[model samples]
Target chain A: MARKIVLIGPQRLQPTLAATVESLGVAGRIAAVTAGWEEREGEDRELHEHLGGRTTNLEAWTRVEDVMSADGELTGMIRQRADRLRAAHELYRLRLAHALDAARELLKREPQAGFEDLLEAEREAALRAVRVVDASHLERVSAIHAEFGAEAQPARRTSIRKHRAELEAQLKPCELLCIAGGHVVVLLHRLALLDVLGLWGERRPIVAWSAGAMALAERVVLFHDDPPQGAGNAEVYEPGLAAYSGLVPLPHARRRLRLHDGVRVGLMARRFAPDRCVALDALTRVEWDGSAWRGEAGTQQLDRQGHLTEVRS
Target chain B: MSGFVAELEQEARRGHHALEAFLRGRRFPVVDGRSVTFVWRGEADEVLLRHWIHGLPGGLPFHRVPGAGLWFLAIDVPEGSRVEYKIEVARWGERRLMADPLNEHHAADPYGANSVVHAQGYAPPEWIAHDAEARAGELREHAVRSQAYGGERRVQVYLPARFRTTRRYPLLVVHDGEDYLRFAALKTVLDNLIHRLELPSMVVALTQSPNRLEEYADDPRQARFLVDELVPELERAYPLVQKPAARGMMGASFGAVASLSAAWRHQGVFGNLLLQSGSFVFTDIGQHDRGPLFDPVVRFVNAFRRNPGRPAEHIYLSCGVYESLIYYNRSLMPLLSKSGMTVRFSESHDGHNWENWRDRLREGLSWLFPGPLWMVYE
Candidate 1:
């Protein structure tokens, strides 16, 4: 998470992109795109009037039909899904960074010896916990990393004066850049941010929307298929981090859904795989005040597609 | 409530049929049982089966008119519908159906539950569906919160009965918390079994040592974390019996050795030993005194080889007869038999999977508690 860049959500990102167009913001220099939704469909997603620690809400979802153009809605759906996966990956990496921090902190407690002492009994005491894969698969993971090939590194450290001079040259600071629909660009941006952060050891705010959102995690397994009605993607899940943690970033949810006309929840349920969620309607995001991540209104939440009922009125 | 459609008891017996109470009141016993051949235009869900015998507690156990066990009391409903309901055994006496074995949300009390046919199908809570979708989005949350490694498989929290703000409970420390949560179905079992009053009111901390090998072997750091970190954290959150005898340690395979060794090393902390499918041959590590592998559980079994005032009062050791490690499982059985450690052993048809372990969990909990009725200890 390069705090310099953040994407709010698809709808919010749309308006933010517009705002960027007017004021030449961080995302203004770079193009904003989305794979899950077409231009029209992507435009329909709204921006949150507010932001905070609240969770995925039911009121924030915009139907795929409403978001994308009629002719290219299907393609838009595929892109949206890919975008989500990549965004999830970015989020996972951000979390890994946090877990590494926590794991490091545990070392302080058991400074005398092995890491076994650092693994809190409470970690194991959690009656409700899940084991992803084991150490046996470490080699496979390494191979997967190798398959991706060695990524290029950022510029190295210069003299203190030179570094300060470069910082002075780069006077314009980093701001949050949110994107929706653009799966590849979004993922590229996340990778770029992660690498930049690793090189400089700096933390920045990042809020991504839709595909951009899903790209924030560890690995983005693409789920790009033509949705019958809506503009969204089918997501496959994988492991990324150790605990439930992250800065809460809220995304505005849209009203009404398209694909399956409203039955996508069940499809999303069975297909979302392990450690994943569809988070309809509302989704928010927030900042961390050291200890825990807190959310404010409209910041982050999985908006529910309100339960259907027959009303007395 | 209008959003909630009801679910009726669906029997699938060979030659019986179901009758809905609502339909019964509306129409005649349309499909009479006496009629050799009967035909009715009814949706499977619409017909609620009532198995009512004449003189029973809830007048249950009678057959439906034209259906059998495993039949669905279906209704003409759309695929996206959510509903809930139960069966009403409307007969003339005290004999009532125990409860639907298939239904996870069953009666808290099997012996006595009002036979009010609740016709509601399985409708997951709002949070479940939200989190179900949000489960994907929340990955960042789980990954950061946990210290395991890359990601989280699942989160399994065991909320014991007395684990409210009012009372305290002891810890029945366990390893491989993930397997216990997924395969063992500890929460569901604890909920139902406790309702049945089978096990004692204690907390079992099903855990997993990220460093499984060393933790299961002779790793003091792993042991210290469980005792110093895990124990106190659980003590803060849950209710515990607290005393050494009241506390226990249990596991299978490496976990089995870990449990026994943990108790052995910290004798006064853990007294009860539940070793299942343990590999105690010591052939792999034959040189290191073979003690770390075999000493703890064996010491608990022999109690210093001279009945040392029974260090552990309750001990349960079980394993599949056809298991790869049956030698270790069986050899220790006879050795453990000497102390009359309130043992009950059996051979089941399943191999080494969660299924076998799940079956054993119920039996083990029952043996531990024995309920207020079958008080073996007293």
Candidate 2:
């Protein structure tokens, strides 16, 4: 069966979720997963009102907290898994920094008569190095997850099963799933733990924005050209839920990434080749209809030449 | 000499006709690139540039135009620097400092006002201005009885726009509240930041002191008044978050000393602190050089260094590189970090003034109490 998905920009400042849903002609109950909100997980009054008060907050963060408190053994294993992921991420970050630096240095060199081809090849190699690092990190994270899955057997755990059952029951009546943006990892963790995707069924339409959009992709890449502290290198965080594939959603790209610098833009695009590097700024909307993608006006994707082009089918 | 200065000198030498017209047409303190030329068109025995920027000479002499009353001094200020100064004029064996007659820009403080010079790339932050789109927060004055002070203290509480009684909010207690409102444009900054989603819409308590120099010098009574009297009163009145992490304290200069002292003495009352250009004078060996006014400050800072405890979870400290107190602020960073507290230290090219403190508000407030922008985007 064909799946339907809609990706929107961040909804905090200028909420477009309701409008986007209406544009898609989607009506009925919306099962919202605001686990990313963390401490304020169930505080979705504004969201409910925006969606005409038919939104049922899943409260996945609270549920996970409850589960962790009640089940000590599972909590310990989860903590161990987190530590392993952290170590993996640190190692990935180290490699990514060096790779990105090399790529930047190569890109910084002005193109000369004879050195154009040579520099291009070197740039490609540097980009490949970044990709290799990202792939290795993703592989390690996937291995850790697989290992945890086999050992912990979350399906057999009574506490997880209870929560999963309740979530499934709550989701049964809802026609659409709306995921709000927040700390992507937290949202991923909660959603993955309860297996919300599995419960919702693949055929139902899903709408997500910002970090939520990133969470829906097959691969999650965290990018920020300039952050308050640190080297500001983009790194592969972890594999996403694979609700959608073949795209890297860069939310708040205008604010976070230096889109004007062709070198950085081209490097990012080439590094994540085969997958379109989409810039999802405010008021951006894109839809996937099983086979191809369609975008509204002002939707942009990073091209091989580093220029922002209209998103094409 | 700069081209502009040379041109003015040439014009003065040629005749007074063009020079007078040029002076009338153009503004003083001509900023070209990084070079700023201060022009004074008056007769005097000598003219000097008196500025508050540390490391630079306190007074730089202005050379006469040779044949004209116009005196000029060109100084190279770094990019994005805001300098406050006065023109010291000497005549008839008497010297008096006065604001530049040609410069209209001025920054006012408790003492008085100083003529302002904005070098290349220095502009007040856009967020500091009043935005019509941003909903304004309400500032209500309250009189709280203080046992420590043995009197009634007036505090202005700022409740965010669309404030709900059911929903609780984080509280930020600000020292020198009236001064911040007047000079720093605190209310406008808060409204804009909150509206922009760069800062969470939270309650702010603006406090003032009858005698700040004495009281804000890390007085125990001041700390007791804040942590014990003011906080409890605010908690009872407003729907403030009860936990320590939800509460923050902020102040500049001597007020910073009071904030740190209150947090230190109370130990876990305020989880966040925003200290700007703190007058944290300390002596490593002998007595300090800041005179008697900083005596209490030096004592408290020295004590804090000796046994630095975990006063707050997060501390945002900002200081101007031009201020003499930068060294002390830099010294305190390591101590605070070593005490197992999350510390973010920032330094600007400005000075220890209200505007400098105002410029740092966005970073400090946003980091301490992040809004939906950070949460949703990252």
Candidate 3:
């Protein structure tokens, strides 16, 4: 329910945070969440300087670490949730791998003479199977999150309540929320624990980049065409915060994905149809102004034909 | 004979073309699918191909072409295979080994250099080369006082580019560090992989032994020198992540033995290990035939095989299928897996050499300390 959500590319090589903020005419103290940085969450000096020293780190990661250390019951519940999430992800990954492999094999097969239509139908069916698997995984993750929320009732907890109140106080005077990229799952977990999204609901404009952008989508899809270990299949990681919908933000797509392989690009695009699979590379800036999405020049999205097309609207 | 080799022989028989002139413009070790024909043009009474490929003859006699000084040996090498060999030239009843003068590709080791041949599908990994775009890491030399060795041991520490004192990094102690740098191109690999985000920026301590054969062969002093002496010194000097999981050790051949032995002796100190072509020679019922140097190594490996005892949490091991030590490395995989350590084993169609070890670095290092590629999309 945010007023406006600005999604930027990775900040490591080419940081666009300051430029993006200035371009949007946003000023004053900005609230930043670096929970995704994990142990290095406290190291935000560079970010602060980039934002002209008007940034306040929310310290959501530190808060969770502290609360978990002090409250044993909350820690146990979080651990339980994590274990469940891991188990669910493993099961989903197993199914996803097989489904994706089947789809790829079908796509790679040469159609028999005059049987091209039949082969095309079979390929479509295979793609549908992969999409179904992804949907099922997202559904499972949503269930797990809902179950944990119901059981934990984190707002009512003593340790979490104290930290949440402090966070709310710190966020009250902030004009904008800046989220830096790191581990997407970790970022999502921290944001959920503190209910940061719930607190900032429709209050202020937000700017996020990399995993930060991915965490704002409806569904979080983890993709890597080639990894050191494993088959490098893209899998549905979990449900996102749904800050904005209809797009699966793929940061570092140029490096992590085999973009040149039309078959791979086409399958990924088709699998996540309806929701545009946007490739958010360096210096990219995309904005959702409460209604439609607008992108800067060089912004690209995967098309049905397995090619990168410029994002028009 | 291949068409090229046949043409060369025909030209030599015609006596119109000088053999040296014919060989001048052409490359040696001509590869045709899986068949590799190694050609040598020199004067000698007897010539032999000395190679280290397992399941093949140690020395293959090169057939001397009649009425020509050219010698040729053709062997069916599998595609993607990288073989290193030397040509043994015997003159006046004395034989001497030398690298193929005609072959420009060579891989150097601690002893000397050997001519290298890449079959149809083999090429050195792109990551092994120096990428101009990738910022190179800084290598600083340090001398650590070692009580175990009764002398000062020189160690080189590699600090990744854009390193900041404010940030803490993972530590990896590599044995035979100099050789890895010179022969395996470890620095360039580290630099490229780090820049690519395949591996996190790390602090690597490259340790070398003055007497590696004796020390690296599971010597207790070597283990003590590494864990007890070198690690503490490095930790105190550098801003390293003070956790077992963030620390790792790596080495190749006998150096691998050193890495494993150190981690095993000082359990919970290092959480990851990258062992390449480990000389883990051991005997089940009888003495090992690897001679006296392996006596202590055999004893240590035998005992370790019996009780691995969870030395580290994650272990990455790689060996060449063409190495004689491949059997031992393969045998240790099940043991490491059963010990509850997450183990990844990789095998390549290569021999026990530096390039083989170099090629496996990307896989081994990335698995041990994965970069922010998955975490940070940037």
User: What residue runs in model 2 are displaced by over 4 Å at the alpha carbon?
Assistant: A12-19, A27-91, A147-175, B12-28, B41-48, B55-70, B88-105, B126-145, B156-173, B187-205, B230-248, B263-274, B282-291, B302-318, B326-347, B362-375
Model 1 chain B: lowest-lDDT 10 consecutive positions: B133-142
TM-score against native, each model: 0.31, 0.83, 0.86
What C-alpha lDDT, on a 0 to 100 scale, does residue B249 get in candidate 3?
96
Candidates 1 onward: DockQ, in order: 0.01, 0.26, 0.40
Which residue pairs overlap in candidate 2's backbone?
none
Interface RMSD, every prediction, one decimal place? 26.5, 4.2, 2.5
Higher-scoring candidate on lDDT, 1 or 2: 2
lDDT: worst 10-residue window of model 3 chain A:
A227-236
Order candidates by lDDT, high to low: 3, 2, 1
Candidate 2 chain A: 10-residue stretch with minimal lDDT: A223-232
Sorted by DockQ (best first), the order is 3, 2, 1
lDDT of 2 by residue, B18-133 (tens): 88876676776899999999998788999999988899889999998876887999999899999889999999999999999899889888888999899899998888988886
lDDT per residue for candidate 3 within B1-378, as digits (tens), equals 567667777778877366657667677788878889888776788889999999888899988887777789988888899999999989899999999988999999989999999999999998898898789999999989999989798999999987888779999999999999999999999999998778999999998888899999989999999888998999899999989999999999999999999899989999999999999998999788999999989999999998899889999999999999999999999999999999999999999999999999999999999986665553
Tens digits of per-residue lDDT for model 1 on B1-378?
Answer: 111112223322212333343233322111122211111232232223333221213322222334422233322322222222235333344332334333443221212432212222323222111121111100011111223233432323365543344445545777776666555555566555543334555566667666676657645555666566666656665556677766767777778767655555565676577766665443323243445545544443443334323435677777755465665566655555675554555554333444456557766655654432111000
